[model samples]
Target: MTKIECILRPGKLEDVKDSLNKYGIHGMTVTQVIGCGLQKGRKEVYRGTEYSINLLPKVKLEIVTKDEDVDEVVKIISQAARSGEIGDGKIFTYKIDNAIRIRTGETGEAAI
Candidate 1:
Protein backbone atom coordinates (compact mmCIF):
# COMPACT_ATOMS: atom_id res chain seq x y z
CA MET A 1 0.00 0.00 0.00
CA THR A 2 1.06 3.61 -0.47
CA LYS A 3 0.30 6.63 1.68
CA ILE A 4 0.15 9.91 -0.18
CA GLU A 5 0.36 13.20 1.67
CA CYS A 6 -0.32 16.45 -0.15
CA ILE A 7 0.12 19.97 1.19
CA LEU A 8 -1.76 22.49 -0.90
CA ARG A 9 -3.14 25.99 -0.88
CA PRO A 10 -6.33 26.23 1.18
CA GLY A 11 -8.25 27.51 -1.84
CA LYS A 12 -7.47 24.36 -3.78
CA LEU A 13 -9.05 21.92 -1.40
CA GLU A 14 -12.38 21.60 -3.13
CA ASP A 15 -10.80 21.12 -6.52
CA VAL A 16 -8.53 18.38 -5.24
CA LYS A 17 -11.30 16.62 -3.40
CA ASP A 18 -13.65 16.71 -6.36
CA SER A 19 -10.99 15.41 -8.72
CA LEU A 20 -10.15 12.50 -6.43
CA ASN A 21 -13.80 11.64 -6.06
CA LYS A 22 -14.22 11.50 -9.85
CA TYR A 23 -11.49 8.87 -9.84
CA GLY A 24 -13.38 6.84 -7.25
CA ILE A 25 -11.10 7.87 -4.39
CA HIS A 26 -13.47 8.81 -1.57
CA GLY A 27 -11.61 8.09 1.63
CA MET A 28 -9.10 10.63 2.87
CA THR A 29 -8.05 12.77 5.80
CA VAL A 30 -7.93 16.55 5.53
CA THR A 31 -6.17 18.83 7.96
CA GLN A 32 -5.48 22.54 8.24
CA VAL A 33 -1.76 23.16 8.67
CA ILE A 34 0.81 25.92 8.77
CA GLY A 35 4.12 25.61 6.93
CA CYS A 36 6.87 27.47 5.12
CA GLY A 37 8.96 26.40 2.15
CA LEU A 38 10.45 27.92 -1.02
CA GLN A 39 7.89 30.69 -0.93
CA LYS A 40 9.30 31.80 2.44
CA GLY A 41 5.98 33.41 3.40
CA ARG A 42 5.59 37.16 3.37
CA LYS A 43 5.66 40.40 5.32
CA GLU A 44 2.62 42.03 6.87
CA VAL A 45 2.03 45.39 8.48
CA TYR A 46 -0.28 45.61 11.44
CA ARG A 47 -1.01 49.04 12.91
CA GLY A 48 2.20 50.48 11.34
CA THR A 49 4.28 47.60 12.72
CA GLU A 50 5.96 45.36 10.19
CA TYR A 51 6.30 41.65 10.87
CA SER A 52 7.21 38.55 8.94
CA ILE A 53 4.49 35.94 8.61
CA ASN A 54 6.75 32.99 8.08
CA LEU A 55 4.14 30.34 8.47
CA LEU A 56 1.30 30.19 5.99
CA PRO A 57 -2.00 28.38 6.07
CA LYS A 58 -2.16 25.14 4.11
CA VAL A 59 -4.38 22.12 3.63
CA LYS A 60 -3.00 18.64 4.12
CA LEU A 61 -4.65 15.79 2.31
CA GLU A 62 -3.82 12.23 3.25
CA ILE A 63 -4.85 9.17 1.28
CA VAL A 64 -3.90 5.51 1.51
CA THR A 65 -4.28 3.49 -1.65
CA LYS A 66 -3.16 0.30 -3.33
CA ASP A 67 0.40 0.40 -4.69
CA GLU A 68 -0.65 0.36 -8.32
CA ASP A 69 -2.84 3.39 -7.86
CA VAL A 70 -0.16 5.70 -6.52
CA ASP A 71 0.83 7.30 -9.81
CA GLU A 72 -2.71 8.08 -10.89
CA VAL A 73 -3.59 9.46 -7.48
CA VAL A 74 -0.56 11.74 -7.48
CA LYS A 75 -1.35 12.97 -10.96
CA ILE A 76 -4.91 13.76 -10.01
CA ILE A 77 -3.82 15.75 -6.99
CA SER A 78 -1.12 17.64 -8.87
CA GLN A 79 -3.40 18.68 -11.67
CA ALA A 80 -6.08 19.81 -9.31
CA ALA A 81 -3.81 21.78 -6.98
CA ARG A 82 -1.62 23.57 -9.51
CA SER A 83 -1.79 27.36 -9.77
CA GLY A 84 1.33 28.23 -11.80
CA GLU A 85 2.77 30.11 -8.87
CA ILE A 86 4.96 29.70 -5.86
CA GLY A 87 3.53 28.31 -2.60
CA ASP A 88 1.52 25.80 -4.58
CA GLY A 89 2.65 23.26 -1.95
CA LYS A 90 4.04 19.72 -2.24
CA ILE A 91 3.22 16.02 -2.23
CA PHE A 92 4.93 13.12 -0.46
CA THR A 93 4.43 9.39 -0.63
CA TYR A 94 5.36 6.60 1.77
CA LYS A 95 5.17 2.86 1.64
CA ILE A 96 2.58 1.53 4.04
CA ASP A 97 3.45 -1.80 5.67
CA ASN A 98 -0.12 -2.62 6.53
CA ALA A 99 -3.52 -1.15 7.18
CA ILE A 100 -6.35 -2.37 9.38
CA ARG A 101 -9.98 -1.32 9.47
CA ILE A 102 -10.97 -1.44 13.11
CA ARG A 103 -14.70 -1.87 12.67
CA THR A 104 -14.62 -4.58 10.01
CA GLY A 105 -11.26 -6.13 11.00
CA GLU A 106 -10.07 -5.91 7.44
CA THR A 107 -6.35 -5.80 6.62
CA GLY A 108 -3.99 -4.85 3.78
CA GLU A 109 -5.55 -3.39 0.64
CA ALA A 110 -8.98 -4.48 1.77
CA ALA A 111 -8.67 -2.32 4.81
CA ILE A 112 -7.98 0.77 2.73
Candidate 2:
Protein backbone atom coordinates (compact mmCIF):
# COMPACT_ATOMS: atom_id res chain seq x y z
CA MET A 1 0.00 0.00 0.00
CA THR A 2 1.08 3.60 -0.46
CA LYS A 3 0.02 7.04 0.63
CA ILE A 4 0.22 9.83 -1.93
CA GLU A 5 0.16 13.42 -0.78
CA CYS A 6 -0.09 16.28 -3.24
CA ILE A 7 0.03 19.98 -2.49
CA LEU A 8 -1.09 22.36 -5.22
CA ARG A 9 -2.47 25.80 -5.82
CA PRO A 10 -5.98 25.85 -4.36
CA GLY A 11 -7.57 26.79 -7.64
CA LYS A 12 -6.60 23.42 -9.08
CA LEU A 13 -8.43 21.28 -6.55
CA GLU A 14 -11.67 20.88 -8.46
CA ASP A 15 -9.91 19.91 -11.65
CA VAL A 16 -7.71 17.41 -9.83
CA LYS A 17 -10.67 15.90 -8.01
CA ASP A 18 -12.58 15.51 -11.22
CA SER A 19 -9.63 13.83 -12.85
CA LEU A 20 -9.27 11.45 -9.94
CA ASN A 21 -12.92 10.53 -10.23
CA LYS A 22 -12.59 9.95 -13.94
CA TYR A 23 -9.66 7.69 -13.17
CA GLY A 24 -11.86 5.66 -10.79
CA ILE A 25 -10.29 6.89 -7.61
CA HIS A 26 -13.16 7.44 -5.23
CA GLY A 27 -11.71 8.02 -1.76
CA MET A 28 -9.34 10.73 -0.62
CA THR A 29 -8.74 13.35 2.02
CA VAL A 30 -8.61 17.00 1.12
CA THR A 31 -7.14 19.77 3.21
CA GLN A 32 -6.57 23.46 2.77
CA VAL A 33 -2.95 24.27 3.67
CA ILE A 34 -0.29 26.94 3.59
CA GLY A 35 3.23 26.21 2.51
CA CYS A 36 6.33 27.37 0.65
CA GLY A 37 9.14 25.72 -1.29
CA LEU A 38 10.95 26.95 -4.42
CA GLN A 39 8.19 29.44 -5.08
CA LYS A 40 8.86 31.04 -1.65
CA GLY A 41 5.55 32.94 -1.86
CA ARG A 42 5.16 36.50 -3.18
CA LYS A 43 4.79 40.18 -2.45
CA GLU A 44 1.58 42.18 -2.51
CA VAL A 45 0.91 45.87 -1.91
CA TYR A 46 -2.07 47.19 0.02
CA ARG A 47 -2.64 50.83 0.85
CA GLY A 48 0.79 51.66 -0.57
CA THR A 49 2.46 49.21 1.81
CA GLU A 50 4.44 46.30 0.45
CA TYR A 51 3.96 43.02 2.25
CA SER A 52 5.64 39.67 1.74
CA ILE A 53 3.28 36.74 1.99
CA ASN A 54 5.57 33.91 2.94
CA LEU A 55 2.84 31.33 3.23
CA LEU A 56 0.74 30.61 0.20
CA PRO A 57 -2.60 28.87 0.20
CA LYS A 58 -2.46 25.35 -1.19
CA VAL A 59 -4.77 22.37 -1.53
CA LYS A 60 -3.55 19.09 -0.10
CA LEU A 61 -4.79 15.68 -1.13
CA GLU A 62 -4.10 12.45 0.71
CA ILE A 63 -4.90 9.19 -1.00
CA VAL A 64 -4.17 5.64 -0.04
CA THR A 65 -4.08 3.02 -2.74
CA LYS A 66 -2.59 -0.27 -3.76
CA ASP A 67 1.00 -0.06 -4.91
CA GLU A 68 0.05 -0.47 -8.55
CA ASP A 69 -2.03 2.72 -8.42
CA VAL A 70 0.71 5.04 -7.19
CA ASP A 71 2.15 6.08 -10.52
CA GLU A 72 -1.21 6.60 -12.15
CA VAL A 73 -2.50 8.67 -9.23
CA VAL A 74 0.59 10.85 -9.33
CA LYS A 75 0.27 11.34 -13.04
CA ILE A 76 -3.38 12.31 -12.76
CA ILE A 77 -2.67 14.87 -10.05
CA SER A 78 0.34 16.36 -11.84
CA GLN A 79 -1.51 16.76 -15.09
CA ALA A 80 -4.50 18.32 -13.44
CA ALA A 81 -2.57 20.71 -11.22
CA ARG A 82 0.03 22.04 -13.62
CA SER A 83 -0.31 25.65 -14.77
CA GLY A 84 3.05 26.35 -16.45
CA GLU A 85 3.94 28.75 -13.67
CA ILE A 86 5.65 28.91 -10.34
CA GLY A 87 3.85 27.81 -7.13
CA ASP A 88 2.48 24.90 -9.06
CA GLY A 89 3.26 22.72 -5.97
CA LYS A 90 4.53 19.20 -5.33
CA ILE A 91 3.66 15.54 -4.68
CA PHE A 92 5.06 13.05 -2.20
CA THR A 93 4.50 9.33 -1.69
CA TYR A 94 5.09 7.09 1.32
CA LYS A 95 4.86 3.39 1.96
CA ILE A 96 1.98 2.48 4.22
CA ASP A 97 2.60 -0.24 6.76
CA ASN A 98 -0.97 -0.86 7.71
CA ALA A 99 -4.56 0.27 7.24
CA ILE A 100 -7.79 -0.63 8.97
CA ARG A 101 -11.46 0.08 8.43
CA ILE A 102 -13.04 0.66 11.81
CA ARG A 103 -16.63 -0.28 11.11
CA THR A 104 -15.91 -3.45 9.19
CA GLY A 105 -12.66 -4.35 10.97
CA GLU A 106 -11.00 -4.85 7.66
CA THR A 107 -7.23 -4.68 7.34
CA GLY A 108 -4.49 -4.32 4.73
CA GLU A 109 -5.66 -3.86 1.17
CA ALA A 110 -9.25 -4.60 2.12
CA ALA A 111 -9.26 -1.70 4.53
CA ILE A 112 -8.42 0.79 1.81
Candidate 3:
Protein backbone atom coordinates (compact mmCIF):
# COMPACT_ATOMS: atom_id res chain seq x y z
CA MET A 1 0.00 0.00 0.00
CA THR A 2 0.99 3.63 -0.37
CA LYS A 3 0.20 6.84 1.44
CA ILE A 4 -0.01 10.08 -0.50
CA GLU A 5 0.30 13.39 1.31
CA CYS A 6 -0.44 16.65 -0.44
CA ILE A 7 -0.01 20.15 0.93
CA LEU A 8 -2.03 22.71 -1.00
CA ARG A 9 -3.81 26.05 -0.99
CA PRO A 10 -6.98 25.99 1.09
CA GLY A 11 -9.17 27.08 -1.79
CA LYS A 12 -8.17 24.04 -3.84
CA LEU A 13 -9.41 21.47 -1.35
CA GLU A 14 -12.79 20.91 -2.94
CA ASP A 15 -11.38 20.47 -6.40
CA VAL A 16 -8.86 17.95 -5.12
CA LYS A 17 -11.51 16.03 -3.24
CA ASP A 18 -13.79 15.90 -6.23
CA SER A 19 -11.01 14.71 -8.49
CA LEU A 20 -10.07 12.00 -6.01
CA ASN A 21 -13.66 10.76 -5.89
CA LYS A 22 -13.80 10.76 -9.66
CA TYR A 23 -10.74 8.56 -9.64
CA GLY A 24 -12.43 6.12 -7.19
CA ILE A 25 -10.40 7.12 -4.15
CA HIS A 26 -12.66 7.71 -1.16
CA GLY A 27 -10.74 7.62 2.12
CA MET A 28 -8.56 10.53 3.19
CA THR A 29 -7.46 12.73 6.04
CA VAL A 30 -7.39 16.52 5.91
CA THR A 31 -5.35 18.80 8.11
CA GLN A 32 -4.72 22.54 8.34
CA VAL A 33 -1.00 23.29 8.46
CA ILE A 34 1.59 26.09 8.23
CA GLY A 35 4.99 25.97 6.57
CA CYS A 36 7.28 27.64 4.01
CA GLY A 37 9.74 26.73 1.30
CA LEU A 38 11.04 28.50 -1.87
CA GLN A 39 8.27 31.10 -1.52
CA LYS A 40 9.95 32.14 1.74
CA GLY A 41 6.62 33.40 3.05
CA ARG A 42 5.47 36.95 2.40
CA LYS A 43 4.89 40.33 3.94
CA GLU A 44 1.59 41.54 5.40
CA VAL A 45 0.43 44.92 6.60
CA TYR A 46 -1.44 45.21 9.87
CA ARG A 47 -2.37 48.59 11.35
CA GLY A 48 0.17 50.95 9.75
CA THR A 49 3.16 48.60 9.80
CA GLU A 50 4.46 45.84 7.62
CA TYR A 51 5.31 42.48 9.13
CA SER A 52 7.05 39.39 7.78
CA ILE A 53 4.70 36.42 7.68
CA ASN A 54 7.19 33.59 7.69
CA LEU A 55 4.67 30.78 7.71
CA LEU A 56 1.65 30.55 5.49
CA PRO A 57 -1.47 28.48 5.96
CA LYS A 58 -2.00 25.38 3.83
CA VAL A 59 -4.20 22.28 3.72
CA LYS A 60 -2.59 18.88 4.06
CA LEU A 61 -4.33 15.89 2.46
CA GLU A 62 -3.47 12.32 3.27
CA ILE A 63 -4.72 9.43 1.13
CA VAL A 64 -3.87 5.76 1.26
CA THR A 65 -4.30 3.42 -1.70
CA LYS A 66 -2.95 0.29 -3.25
CA ASP A 67 0.32 0.50 -5.20
CA GLU A 68 -1.31 0.37 -8.62
CA ASP A 69 -3.42 3.45 -7.95
CA VAL A 70 -0.50 5.70 -7.04
CA ASP A 71 0.05 7.31 -10.43
CA GLU A 72 -3.60 8.09 -11.09
CA VAL A 73 -4.10 9.47 -7.58
CA VAL A 74 -1.13 11.79 -7.96
CA LYS A 75 -2.37 12.90 -11.36
CA ILE A 76 -5.81 13.72 -9.98
CA ILE A 77 -4.38 15.91 -7.22
CA SER A 78 -1.87 17.58 -9.54
CA GLN A 79 -4.48 18.55 -12.11
CA ALA A 80 -7.01 19.71 -9.55
CA ALA A 81 -4.55 21.64 -7.39
CA ARG A 82 -2.27 23.23 -9.98
CA SER A 83 -2.38 27.03 -10.09
CA GLY A 84 0.81 27.60 -12.09
CA GLU A 85 2.30 29.66 -9.25
CA ILE A 86 4.66 29.41 -6.33
CA GLY A 87 3.22 28.07 -3.03
CA ASP A 88 0.71 26.14 -5.08
CA GLY A 89 1.69 23.09 -2.96
CA LYS A 90 3.43 19.71 -3.08
CA ILE A 91 2.64 15.97 -2.91
CA PHE A 92 4.57 13.25 -1.16
CA THR A 93 4.02 9.48 -1.61
CA TYR A 94 5.25 6.74 0.69
CA LYS A 95 4.70 3.09 1.50
CA ILE A 96 2.26 2.09 4.21
CA ASP A 97 2.93 -1.11 6.15
CA ASN A 98 -0.62 -1.71 7.23
CA ALA A 99 -4.01 -0.14 7.84
CA ILE A 100 -6.95 -1.00 10.04
CA ARG A 101 -10.60 0.05 9.94
CA ILE A 102 -11.42 0.56 13.62
CA ARG A 103 -15.18 0.20 13.48
CA THR A 104 -15.35 -2.75 11.09
CA GLY A 105 -12.14 -4.50 12.11
CA GLU A 106 -11.00 -4.66 8.51
CA THR A 107 -7.31 -4.60 7.51
CA GLY A 108 -5.10 -4.02 4.48
CA GLU A 109 -6.77 -2.84 1.30
CA ALA A 110 -10.18 -3.81 2.63
CA ALA A 111 -9.57 -1.54 5.58
CA ILE A 112 -8.63 1.28 3.25
Candidate 4:
Protein backbone atom coordinates (compact mmCIF):
# COMPACT_ATOMS: atom_id res chain seq x y z
CA MET A 1 0.00 0.00 0.00
CA THR A 2 0.99 3.60 -0.42
CA LYS A 3 -0.10 7.04 0.64
CA ILE A 4 -0.02 9.89 -1.83
CA GLU A 5 -0.23 13.49 -0.70
CA CYS A 6 -0.59 16.40 -3.08
CA ILE A 7 -0.60 20.10 -2.31
CA LEU A 8 -1.86 22.48 -4.97
CA ARG A 9 -3.60 25.75 -5.72
CA PRO A 10 -7.05 25.87 -4.17
CA GLY A 11 -8.70 26.61 -7.49
CA LYS A 12 -7.60 23.26 -8.91
CA LEU A 13 -9.36 21.08 -6.36
CA GLU A 14 -12.51 20.41 -8.37
CA ASP A 15 -10.63 19.46 -11.51
CA VAL A 16 -8.34 17.07 -9.63
CA LYS A 17 -11.25 15.46 -7.82
CA ASP A 18 -13.04 14.85 -11.09
CA SER A 19 -9.98 13.27 -12.61
CA LEU A 20 -9.57 10.95 -9.65
CA ASN A 21 -13.19 9.88 -10.01
CA LYS A 22 -12.59 9.05 -13.65
CA TYR A 23 -9.82 6.72 -12.49
CA GLY A 24 -12.19 5.08 -10.00
CA ILE A 25 -10.41 6.68 -7.07
CA HIS A 26 -13.35 7.73 -4.94
CA GLY A 27 -11.83 7.89 -1.46
CA MET A 28 -9.52 10.64 -0.32
CA THR A 29 -8.87 13.26 2.31
CA VAL A 30 -8.88 16.94 1.47
CA THR A 31 -7.44 19.66 3.64
CA GLN A 32 -6.94 23.40 3.38
CA VAL A 33 -3.30 24.30 4.10
CA ILE A 34 -0.87 27.24 3.98
CA GLY A 35 2.79 27.10 3.11
CA CYS A 36 5.42 28.26 0.61
CA GLY A 37 8.37 26.78 -1.27
CA LEU A 38 10.68 27.76 -4.14
CA GLN A 39 8.36 30.36 -5.64
CA LYS A 40 7.59 31.43 -2.08
CA GLY A 41 4.40 33.48 -1.77
CA ARG A 42 3.20 36.40 -3.79
CA LYS A 43 2.48 40.00 -2.97
CA GLU A 44 -1.01 41.42 -3.11
CA VAL A 45 -2.61 44.85 -2.78
CA TYR A 46 -5.43 45.36 -0.35
CA ARG A 47 -7.16 48.70 0.10
CA GLY A 48 -4.32 50.51 -1.70
CA THR A 49 -1.66 48.85 0.38
CA GLU A 50 0.76 46.15 -0.71
CA TYR A 51 1.37 43.16 1.52
CA SER A 52 3.56 40.06 1.25
CA ILE A 53 1.52 36.97 1.85
CA ASN A 54 4.16 34.48 2.95
CA LEU A 55 1.67 31.71 3.56
CA LEU A 56 -0.33 30.97 0.43
CA PRO A 57 -3.52 29.00 0.66
CA LYS A 58 -3.25 25.48 -0.80
CA VAL A 59 -5.35 22.35 -0.96
CA LYS A 60 -3.88 19.08 0.31
CA LEU A 61 -5.25 15.88 -1.17
CA GLU A 62 -4.34 12.56 0.41
CA ILE A 63 -5.14 9.13 -0.94
CA VAL A 64 -4.25 5.60 0.10
CA THR A 65 -4.11 2.96 -2.59
CA LYS A 66 -2.52 -0.28 -3.60
CA ASP A 67 1.11 -0.06 -4.68
CA GLU A 68 0.21 -0.47 -8.36
CA ASP A 69 -1.96 2.65 -8.22
CA VAL A 70 0.70 5.04 -6.97
CA ASP A 71 2.07 6.11 -10.31
CA GLU A 72 -1.35 6.48 -11.92
CA VAL A 73 -2.67 8.50 -8.97
CA VAL A 74 0.30 10.84 -9.12
CA LYS A 75 -0.10 11.26 -12.86
CA ILE A 76 -3.79 12.04 -12.50
CA ILE A 77 -3.11 14.65 -9.86
CA SER A 78 -0.29 16.26 -11.79
CA GLN A 79 -2.28 16.44 -15.02
CA ALA A 80 -5.30 17.89 -13.31
CA ALA A 81 -3.54 20.38 -11.03
CA ARG A 82 -1.01 21.76 -13.43
CA SER A 83 -1.35 25.30 -14.79
CA GLY A 84 2.10 25.57 -16.35
CA GLU A 85 2.88 28.08 -13.65
CA ILE A 86 4.52 28.27 -10.26
CA GLY A 87 2.58 27.13 -7.19
CA ASP A 88 0.79 24.55 -9.29
CA GLY A 89 1.42 21.96 -6.53
CA LYS A 90 3.56 19.00 -5.46
CA ILE A 91 2.97 15.32 -4.86
CA PHE A 92 4.62 13.01 -2.32
CA THR A 93 4.28 9.24 -1.95
CA TYR A 94 5.10 6.91 0.93
CA LYS A 95 4.55 3.35 1.95
CA ILE A 96 1.54 2.47 4.11
CA ASP A 97 2.04 -0.30 6.67
CA ASN A 98 -1.56 -1.30 7.04
CA ALA A 99 -5.20 -0.21 7.18
CA ILE A 100 -8.35 -1.41 8.84
CA ARG A 101 -12.07 -0.81 8.46
CA ILE A 102 -13.58 -0.27 11.88
CA ARG A 103 -17.17 -1.29 11.28
CA THR A 104 -16.42 -4.53 9.47
CA GLY A 105 -13.12 -5.27 11.23
CA GLU A 106 -11.53 -5.78 7.88
CA THR A 107 -7.78 -5.32 7.50
CA GLY A 108 -5.13 -4.87 4.81
CA GLU A 109 -6.23 -4.73 1.19
CA ALA A 110 -9.63 -6.12 2.07
CA ALA A 111 -10.33 -3.11 4.25
CA ILE A 112 -9.60 -0.75 1.40
User: Could you say which candidate leads in TM-score?
Assistant: 1
- TM-scores of all candidate predictions against the true structure: 0.96, 0.93, 0.94, 0.92
RMSD of each: 0.8, 1.2, 1.1, 1.4
Q: Candidates sorted by lDDT, descending order?
A: 1, 2, 3, 4
lDDT of 3 by residue, 9-92 (tens): 999999999988887877899999999987786889989799999899999999899999899889889999999998899999
lDDT by residue (tens digit), candidate 1, 1-112: 9999999999999999999999999999999999999888689999999999999999999999999999999999999999999999999999999999999999999999
* Cα-based lDDT for every prediction: 0.96, 0.93, 0.92, 0.92
Which residue segments of model 2 deviate by more than 4 Å?
none
| Best-to-worst ranking by TM-score | 1, 3, 2, 4
The total of clashing pairs for model 4 equals 0
Tens digits of per-residue lDDT for model 4, 1-112: 9999999899999999999999998999999999888767778999999999899889899999999988888998999999999889799999999999999999998877
Scored by lDDT, model 1 comes in at 0.96
User: What stretches of model 3 exceed 4 Å from their correct place?
Assistant: none
